[model samples]
Target: MSGASPRGPSVADRGTWPSPGAEAAAHSRRLAGVIGSALDAAGGWLSFADYMQLALYAPGLGYYAAGADKFGEAGDFVTAPEISPLFAEVCAAQIDGVLRALGGGEVLELGPGTGRFAAGALAEFRARGTPITGYSLLEVSPDLRSRQQALLAASDEPPVDARRIPPRWLDSLPAPFRGVLFANEVIDALPCERFVMRGGAAWRLGVGRAAGAARDDMPRFEWRARPADGACTGDAGFVAAMAQRLDDLAAAGVTLPEGCCGEFHPQLAAWVASLADVLEAGLLLFVDYGLPRTQLLHPDRAMGSLRCHHRHHAHGDPFLWPGLQDITAWVDFTALAEAGVAAGLEVAGFTTQAGFLLGGGIEARLAARLAPPTAGEAALGEVARAQLAQGVRRLLLPGEMGEAVKVMALAKDCGAPTAFALQDLRRGL
Candidate 1:
């Protein structure tokens, strides 16, 4: 199922991918036309970040903005929560610690995918007698919101009161907010500023029509390199920020060779800063697939970590289906840590997902499952045990989510929790 393309190796293409239906295809075509118009208005070139924004968030035609099943076998990709409920249980332990440290507070989830994690966490908190004032979701996709609502409503009784924060209210988050903030697999989706190192200079990677491409036909957008002109692309601030990050990486003794291409997320710093600004006290925890700057920018990864996922088909062609595919870039943990520090937050801990979850109590959960049932309780069945084992393997195996997924916790006045401290990998970073 894997193959190499002009870009690089394809990793997500697996299983029987269901083709997009007529409606979805038409939607993609419409989105492509919109992007084409924008490209033409921009003098036939648009920065990759702009293109990504339009592709994933452009009003109603974009991938996320459109109503599409995006989180299961039938969807483009699967997230950890969808994989197993155990993920939320382990996360609950860490969240409980943060809430405990702050006495008691609400839970702010950046993107509650299908509300699975929220449900699991709420159940755990309720079972443990932990008090959660509220569960606030900042989800942008109305389609996803409906799905989340349906899933949560089907539950007999949700432990905490849940509410959605309208996008317009994001700028006015509870002032002096004190709570636990969660962002699982969120930062990776933030638009990345792709840059190309060619001709002994770094040029911004933009999207534009192929040279002499027929306007009458479907506009074929391709990678177009030009001088790093941020103002021309309406991303002046991002240009300066990207330059600073690259300079910082070079100062740390890591540099990419000429003709190499990669991505840097300037929005990450700003996003972290914005969150830190309103937080009077709390912990910001994140889980995503990524690597440290040194490793991420190593000579081995010349093409960077940008990738696309469509119907579980992991590929590198972001230009193929336009708004129909999910585009992402691997997060730079070192960059994240630096940003947290700059924002006056402590880089409490960083480690692999396996380590974090195990420290937070995955083994104990497995042990409880493996142990014999108490009197009048049914023992764990063979099929259930096998399923649990499979989930564990997928979560902890090196070739699976284990090594690739990273856990990082940033804190305000609250110190690092013991759960994360157990396997802190900040030294490696």
Candidate 2:
């Protein structure tokens, strides 16, 4: 709901990006054609959410659907899990607490990128002697799923004990479950509806074919906006919903000026509610780059939080190479808390990523790694200790993921986890 910058870069900036290989270029062209057909069917205009869905999830040609290195140095960007095993280790401690409170339960992870978190968390659980009933992963991308499988199966990684439960891959959420549900950087990727304020009303921003504009025989797309108040045949509900959202922001002391642009995940409420339905009793934990609604919707961010990542270069052009880039919008945590309450869950705690890490004992973990080395091990130990310190800094520094990212917990028939006790920012929400 936060507004985007007033003067952001134009789509023309995509020219400075490194070009994809011939095969990747062809893949993008094919995806573009698919999108063009969808636009044609939708009267040459598709809501940004719909376009994002296609670009990221379209069968075999989408960014996530196709074969591409998506995490770590070889990919677009690195996640906390990829940065260090300490992230998952700390998270594992939190999960261990929840499982102990519940007597024992399973762990379900959404979008387990590369299975690094799973591997690390499983190891931590084993080290602590936590009795986990099971470990399940709900991943949509076959490509990433295969990668996860390989990583978890590798002999070099921590082994899943025979007495303990083995990891399972799930196509959908299991019902009547009681355990922990974890998602990292997952909500941000959900398809979101972009809107712009005009004449004190909201207009839906969408994608449309750029007339006569073609690059390498692939059709070009441009931004197009339509009044949300019935300008489009099926936008009546959108108009009402956006109106209520803006009204809520106004009540929270945030206002958007005319021409302000932003995005909101229309399906967020339903998504959270679905998770609530499946999680009969347990914790729903989410860690991502986000903020409370008021801070997120501040007027200064007139252009919104939409971003595209390709080969480590972040930009605003979602139109660049379509399926070849990752597109995401910052999350509105205030909305998440509201959804949890409406779904009959308790807003247990919400805090910055730094607070969560520190509370989960990152300092102790680092100290253990940095313990004085023996005579023969001094050199290797020094190098490892330095790397550990750097990774911890990235996770806890205010300018890094520390302050920008937030961790939120929603509980059902459970007490607030100690992980959030260090610094609860729920009052801001």
Candidate 3:
């Protein structure tokens, strides 16, 4: 938010769901005609991944790059962080454990969406009496950054040491800082190159057009890149590096707009390296929905976690609505752990949300919410009780966000002991 002010960033420029059934079919016809001819010149058929990237990230025509309502009741899926205040409250509790253990430090957040998570988390942190210098954010999108700014109007100053770092410069981790570097649903949003495993071959996905479609689209994808001799071992390190591009971008000063099409972060390793270097003694708490490399390339997931979110319907095709929907892939937590270790950070712990919450003394908190009041008033207490119950049901039930997501904490050598309580949960895993 410093330096030059954000450029004419006005989110009101777009607001509305897409209705492309009729128009899309018509547009598809025209695009297929032009695009098909181009593809026919090269060869035939486009891989699903290629087709997906162009549909989702292609400059002016990709899904997320388009102008669609991405979050809330109108968008695809709602993250737990987006649901209610409870998620932040729980996070506040968890962070308190970290700060208390570390004595004191800062809280830096990456890709804080619309400041909702920050608002909730900061509020809870304040309520818990945790001493945080301020909140720093590394945002890539001007629109989202502005939105986050407006949302946190009260704590107008930099949340901590506010800075606009691009996504590709992960090495710029603020050094000598003792605190928590927290990311909520951030890793999954990192760009990733997708590979499809077919007949034991791992081929990268890219876009090229086909000449025979009724409406020839632009350069669609054709899996022309030859695969490695054997099946791809799922290069965890390489994938991590790629995903870290956003972290690197934080410092690189890349100007990303609403409609620019580009590849997903392909530089995760560098990002991790930066964090490891600057984290003198602190925790890297990653809360996201990701899997280890094994599960990522499992036969069932051979196609990779590549999927497009259009009107909330996830599909492999990104062309459903250009500059409208979200293009995201599943993150590999196992890969993240590997990257952390490679960067000299010890993998302190990993567990499902249920495990983390339960391990972090959530049971006691939940019990307190339900404990029968001794001298409380009457109706007011009952209403508060109902709300508390609602939070528990939404956050703890396995069928909900509870068991669906996972939390991982990586730490430097000096900070491992403080994370021990929660680390115990992932011991047997």
Candidate 4:
């Protein structure tokens, strides 16, 4: 979900994209049936958040729930860790500093896609002699968990010793846990509610059956907008929340023009509270593409940040293939900070990914990789060096993941991580 094509497809370009195979189409149809039933029970209207939740997490049908290759070259998108081991290596440095500060602690990773980061970090930790009590991954997808186990098992660089901690999978957040919890490009995937401002009122954008489409037809879907007031069956208090959000923006000297649309993660507060409830003392780190409220809800971005990806083709249509494509919205860092603070965690640091990497000594890692091979080591070929350099550029350039991806750290009874020392953008939040 990290390295999506910047230029998404338009309505006209949808036809040019590859068509789903028979099996994929049938899978989508089955998921559509599930959604259609839910829609029927909901009186033909379901909030976008509700639809998104089902599309991405519904048991055995949603995107992540089913068995699908969702990472790397063969998947829908490539994440930072997939881009290069440098990302995980630098992240390990930050985690190492925190663990050392706390004497010792574990590392809990949320949505550890493909186990690439876990493998790279474990290797780095072993090399640096970093003391970690354990390494755990909280993956919701059964398919993904199996894949993680397979990859980690086949890894050449296993734990330093048999006694050393090996990665374990978690069913839920461990209560009273003391560790470092981090997620890369995970928050953006959380279901969010889409809203549009019209004539100073907010309307919740949702999904419903297309006009005149028969139930027997290929379950067509369409956008449906309703008042954000409590009148809707499942949208109670939506109006008040929207109003409050807009009022807060107005207080900051920004106002959304009429017809402006955007998304907000409805479960952000509760989600952070859940993390806070579990961690006795640790850091919560989230890295994703987003901006502070002021910029995110600014007038310039009137169209919003909702995006979908299928086979590397980014588009704006979430209705194209339910439970088949990846859907995401840009994170609201300001909201995330507010939630963390409300949940009794201190805002440790906030900065761009580029800043975090540089602060965590990515330069040193790059230098070592570029260094000549040892007498017995294999030579670093010119092509491999160029690829490595290209990957670094993609991770650090302002126009790429560097600026788009923001890193935020929240802590409870822990010190600020060293990764945000280079530049702190907390003021914007």
- The model with the greatest TM-score is 4
Task: Find the 10 residues in a row with the least total lDDT in model 2.
Answer: 1-10
- Lowest lDDT block of 10, candidate 4: 3-12
- For residues 58-103, write the lDDT of model 4, one tens digit per residue: 9999999998887766777778898878999999888988888888
Write the candidate numbers in order of decreasing TM-score.
Answer: 4, 2, 1, 3
- Please list the Cα RMSD from the true structure of every candidate, rounded to 1 decimal place: 4.0, 4.0, 11.1, 2.2
Candidate 3 C-alpha error for residue 288, in Å: 1.2
TM-score of 2: 0.94
Clashing pairs in 4: none
lDDT of 2 by residue, 253-308 (tens): 77799989888888888999999998878999999888887777768879888888
What is candidate 1's lDDT per residue for 123-205, written digit by digit as tens?
77777766567677777777777777777767655645333221121313555678788989888888888887777556788
Model 3 earns a TM-score of 0.69
State which candidate, 1 or 3, has the greater TM-score: 1
Q: Which residue pairs come into collision in candidate 1? A: 12-314, 13-313, 13-314, 197-259
TM-score of each: 0.90, 0.94, 0.69, 0.95
Error of 4 at 343 (Å): 0.7
lDDT of 1: 0.77
Better of 3 and 4 by lDDT: 4
What C-alpha lDDT do the candidate models reach, one value each? 0.77, 0.84, 0.56, 0.85
Q: Write the per-residue lDDT of candidate 3 for residues 196-277, one digit (tens) a residue.
A: 4334333445445423442333333343443433233334533444344333333444323322222333556667778777
Error of 2 at 67 (Å): 0.7
Tell me how many clashing residue pairs each candidate has: 4, 9, 68, 0
Off by over 4 Å in 2: 1-15, 159-162, 231-234, 374-380
Count of clashes in candidate 4: 0
